[model samples]
Target: MGRGRGRDYTGRTMPSPSSAIRPKRGKKGSETPIVTPVSARKRVAPSRQVVRGDRGVKVTRAVTIRRSADELYAFWRQIENLPRIVKHPLTIERVSDIASHWAASAPVGDRRVEWDAVIINDEPGKLIAWRSREGAEIPNAGTVRFAPAPGDEGTEVTVTLEYNPPAGKLGAWFAKLSGQEPAQQVTEALRRFKALMEAGEIPTTEGQPSGRPQNTKAKRS
Candidate 1:
């Protein structure tokens, strides 16, 4: 203690530097955190195909009518007669040389389906094609072709149709359950049209009378 050393009040001897002094520790080793910018990210837009899903309906069918191509084409070109021939509740109003308004049966009587359509192609006595306008009640398009049969069997009428029903394919299936399928309706329409054109009347078990012809006279004199 007398050899140049410091001591506490109660200490008989003070610890030497060799035993008391020690090195201090460095700061804990830890890496800094990093951040990313929002502007450097990738984004994707929606696709129409996914939204559309499986809502398309396509049908191709043909019928051979005992009438000439020109006669069939002329009769079909008169849009007003569609309701009578289609075998469904339908009405067509001509807007111009290329456009028209159409209404067809749906579920109820007064609450029918309606749309506007424009004639896209018109090959006289051969083909007629049409498509519905944008935002229609039921979007649709179709084509009708009239060609001479191989023999004297009149004309071969081929109809091709593609449509997006209001309820899509599901709607078509539902229509089948309700006996309102378009394909069957078209086939029946073609058959009825053939009967009407060739026989001047559509046959019915109800015995309904056919309308008078253009060359009919009465004995009113």
Candidate 2:
């Protein structure tokens, strides 16, 4: 007898178990991994925002000066007085009839920043507006307006300044904390200018002695 023969011996064949192996059943303890359906996922739209650093900090300040508008405008035309009025270490040198060069110190270190600006608009005894030239240290523009006060109440000097801070909004906030903010600086400058133009000097407490000088000394006695 041969196994290959479908029929054996007397033309009759016995039934045999199936030649193909059946697949083993899964264990009772086995579990299928749960997959989240794509329809259940949340889709979020992207946000459109104006970056803080890209926008500038705008500061507007006004003060009343007893001097005439013409006189005030003439006084301001001399840019040399700017450094004295401003709290920051800065200087402005005239380049031409309508252009000037500005130099300022960095807030954190010994770096020097320079820029050139051309007067875009100027109305005698009324307004002056300027914008920084191309490739300046930082983008900046400003306008100052002089208006006559009512009832002979001197002149109203309005200043508007805008600049993109290096470190963005956070840096502007930090500068405000340190009293170097643009608003504070412009306000104080106006105050100083008022005092200087009216009183011929800026009042100070430098000569007055303080209650405690011990902290200032390197070594206490």
Candidate 3:
């Protein structure tokens, strides 16, 4: 006769070990959350604060010149005329009606940095704005506005410039040390521009005598 089914002491068929029902593996959604001990948690390093002046530095200057708004606007609208009015050793070459390439001598070296810029806004006899294009050595932007001065005092020209120097704050510091700070440069440029517009020339004291002992003696007649 064939082997009969195995029975336990209670006379019930006993389930074989291999045939016993087991818990089925459930999907990932049914997993329980993991909890790590406080002592075993990782410590994340804190982040550093960003430098404030890294973005750029801004300088604004205003002047009143005894010239009509249209005349000043026309002169300034021509980008090629910039070097004629400013004291800085700057050169600009127009690439198109609204774009130009600019180069200027660095304050601490014989090196010259250049960039291309495009006009972003223009309003005849009112305002003009421009910004440097991508990959510029020193990114910069500027705006010039012309408005009527009080009591027929001619036009008020205001210029605002924001730039990120080549080395950021360090470069700005060097510029200040070399007497080429943007603020001072802008102020002097406007002064020169005013003189040129009103007097038709830039007055200067070149070759003037100084209070040095060697130069105190006059030439014998």
Candidate 4:
């Protein structure tokens, strides 16, 4: 064999390999796989968004009412008018142009919960957003949006609320079981608001007899 050449098993002359470095290969019929170390690998980000509270619950409800956005906005802008649309009694005492004090009966008991809120964003006839002040009994934040409905029908109102339940997840579960969860409350409130705006009154079964009324008037001949 020459200095730069070698003879293969078939007795054919082949050039010698270069001096470049190369990865070592395993034996015939066996292969080695490259693996990234844990510290060097790129981690995938979490898919879900991180909400405000550690145990926060968000509820959203929307309704279309046969009323103009301006009219609906006017009614909702005044903090005192909220009681008219809320089934569970609410009292809102205005402290300023953008702040108010709120009190409402607790879902699970006769006791009342109170919170102070200040409007964070407000656009006439379009949007209103607020957040409870620090030390509030129920820390919460919410937004109400009013937009013109499709086909010029009326206004579309959407309400979104985020709050940390009093006792965390357990309290939320109890509230749901009692039909007083934020979702249920928001749904009912929106329904009542729609009724009031479209029909001028909210329908209720209060003070109604269980059975059908008798024919108090005389029957026709």
Query: 1-221 in candidate 3: lDDT tens per residue?
Result: 31222222223343321221111124231122111111122331110111124345544557889999999999899999889877767899999999999987765456677889888778899877777777776667677888999897899887866665556654774466425445556667788888889999989987688877666776434
TM-score (all chains, Cα) for each model:
0.64, 0.66, 0.66, 0.66
Question: Which residue pairs come into collision in candidate 3?
Answer: none
Tell me the tens digit of each residue's lDDT in model 1 across 1-221: 24323222223333322221221123111111011111111221121221233454544456788889999999889888778887666789999987999976665443667789887678898878777777776566677888888987898887756565556654654465325445555566777888899899998866334445532343224
Model 4 score (lDDT):
0.62
**Which ten residues in a row are the worst by lDDT in model 4?**
14-23
- For model 2, the stretches where C-alpha displacement exceeds 4 angstroms are 1-54, 107-109, 168-180, 214-221
C-alpha lDDT of all candidate models, in order: 0.60, 0.60, 0.64, 0.62
Q: Report how far residue 89 has shifted in candidate 3, in Å.
A: 1.2
Best by lDDT: 3
List the candidate 1 regions with Cα displacement exceeding 4 Å.
1-53, 108-110, 168-180, 207-221
Worst 10 residues of 2 by lDDT: 43-52
Candidates 3 and 4: which is better by lDDT?
A: 3
TM-score: model 3 vs. ground truth: 0.66
- Clash-forming residue pairs, model 4: none
Error of 1 at 179 (Å): 2.3
State the number of backbone clashes in model 1.
Answer: 0
Where does candidate 3 stray beyond 4 Å? 1-54, 107-109, 168-180, 209-221
What TM-score would candidate 1 get against the native? 0.64
